[model samples]
Target: MIILYNLVLLVMRAGYNIAALFHNKARAFVTGRKDVFTKLGDYFRQNHAKVVWVHCASLGEFEQGRPLIESIKKEYPQTKILLTFFSPSGYEVRKNYDQADFIGYLPWDSAANAERFISIVKPTLAVFVKYEFWHHYAKALKQHQIPLLSVSSIFREEQMFFKPYGGFYRGILKNFSYFFVQNETSLHLLKSIGIDACAVAGDTRFDRVYAIVKQGGEIPVARQFKSDQKTFVVGSCWPEDFEVLTPLINENRIKFIIAPHEITETFMAAMESSLQVKSVRFSQAAGKPLEDYQVLIIDNIGMLSRLYRYGEFAFIGGAYGKGLHNILEAACYGVPIFFGNKDYEKYQEAVDLINRGGAFEVRDYTDLKAKYEMLNSPETFLLACEVTRLYVEENLGATEKIMHYCRTLLA
Candidate 1:
């Protein structure tokens, strides 16, 4: 099984190298790991502090792991954090994150790389956020007698760990010293497999988003653009979502602020071409009269969370394509969120919000229009807002529970 996994990694690395020639993201994935071991070794040699390693697969997982990271920094001020990402999406965005002492790409999951990495870092503890289970890395951590934790984890029966021919994969779960899972289903799944070093700690992202609400300050541009108008914020949108949303945007009933998932020149231009109403990109809005335009296009990243503060409604995109982006970012603001009605069942919050009447799923233009109109009434809108707000508040404190467990482990 280990040999087969190594073979798969080898093939994937070769495939990515070839793909790098033509793709920017693929190129980043290949180039970012260049001399990563030398970098890790050089950084750790002089530091020699008690290090806690936190591994996240991408940006979403980073958000899920962030509250815990910051909390660890606060409680264990002397302990150094080594944060690693498996994808460029997370590494590129948060490479310079201040909470972690060291941040880098996780060297691809080979036994040799894992052994070398463990030896070089010599962490007191290792943490894997959400679905980041690496066979070789888990084994290496166990060999070194390091405590490994799985945080904000969820498991489904369809996963290999529960399957008839999945003993190799199931062995990976046993490597973890403990698990802080998201819900009862995950707890039940692990218990059924005879893995009892786990508990339901909910999701750390709830704590993270609530912190954002407390710390959120005003974005001058967002405030200026909104300027007393009923605004709709569109976050992490894709071309597919835009196709369904463009007609509604053209109607110009309410002001719209769109932040596309990818800010590529081509996609932005395509979005602009499709919109019939007057619009302005955030970059160029500095000199223009902000209120003159009906649509405001966000041309950069990192402001979507704060941008929700100025909106009364939100459409979080990505469900129209691969999967749903983070609705929790917008939901934290207590807005009635809408998304494309596909592939959102995987998100527990989305399902909960839909059931609680805090969110709605739209299939197309007609679905969007009808559902959106239903929320136009002040009474109905306020009810949804309260539901969404209370939902976020109720889910808080997962980080504290996980931290309490970590205190015992670290002691």
Candidate 2:
């Protein structure tokens, strides 16, 4: 199985190398690993502090892992954190994040690479956030007697670990000292596989978002743009989302702020052209009168979370395409969320919000318009706001629970 995994890795590396010629992300993936070990080695040689390693696959997992990361740092102030990312999206955005002591791309998961990585960093504890499970790395951690954990893990029956011919992957699960899963379903799934080192801790993202709510400050631009109007914030939107939302924006007298998932010039231009109302880009709106335009297009990243504060309600994008983006971000502000009716089954929060009357899943423009009208009522809007706020409030404290377990493990 290890041999097969290595072969697969080699093929993937070759494919990435070839793809690098045409694709910028693929190119970064290939280029980022050049002398990765040397960089890690130099850092290790210089810093002899006790290390806690946290691995995340990408941005979503990073968000899931963030509250724990900050808590760990607070409790173990002397311990250095070595944060590793498997994708450019996470690493690129958070490479300069000050919380982690060191940040870098995780070297490809090969036996030798894992062995070398474990030797250099020698983390006292290792945490894998969400779905990342590398066999060789798990094996190395086990061999080194490092306490390994999986946080905010969710499982489905279709996953290989639960499959008939999944012994190899199942072995990887055994390497974890504990699994803090997001739901009871994940706990039951692990139990069926005879994995008892697991518990239901709920999703840490709720904790993260709740923290955002408490600590959230005003974004001047967002505040200026809203300016007492009933504003709808559209976050992480895609082209498909715009297609469904454009007509709604054209018809409504309410203010709109759209932050697209991809902020490429061409994509922004396409979005601007689709909206019939006067729109201003965030970059250009700084000194200008924002109230003159009906739409404010966020052309950059990093402000979407803060932007939700100024919104009366929100439309979370990505459901029309791959998956739904984070509705919890908007929900934290006690706003009713709207999204496309596609691929929402995988997101437990979205499903729960729909059932709890905190969110609406619209199939198209007509459905969106209808839902908007439904929410336009003062009584209905207030009820949905309370429901969303309560949902977020009820789910808090996963971070504290996980941190308690970690303290016990470390003690």
- Against the reference, the lDDT scores of all candidates come to 0.92, 0.91
Q: RMSD of each candidate? A: 2.7, 2.6
- What's the TM-score of each model vs. the native? 0.89, 0.90
Give the per-residue lDDT of model 2 (tens digit) for 77-110: 8889999999999999999988999899999998
What tens-digit string does per-residue lDDT give for candidate 1 at 1-411? 778888999999999999999999999999999999999989997776789999999999999899988989998888999999999999999999999989999999988899999999999999999999999999999999999999999999999999988999999999999999999999999999889999999999998887876788888887888889999999998999999999999985689999999999999999889988888999988978887788999999888888998899999998988999889888889999999998799999999999999999999999999998999899999999999999998888999999998898665
Q: Which pairs of residues have clashing backbones in candidate 1? A: none
Error of 2 at 295 (Å): 3.3
> Can you give the lDDT of residue 357 in candidate 2?
99
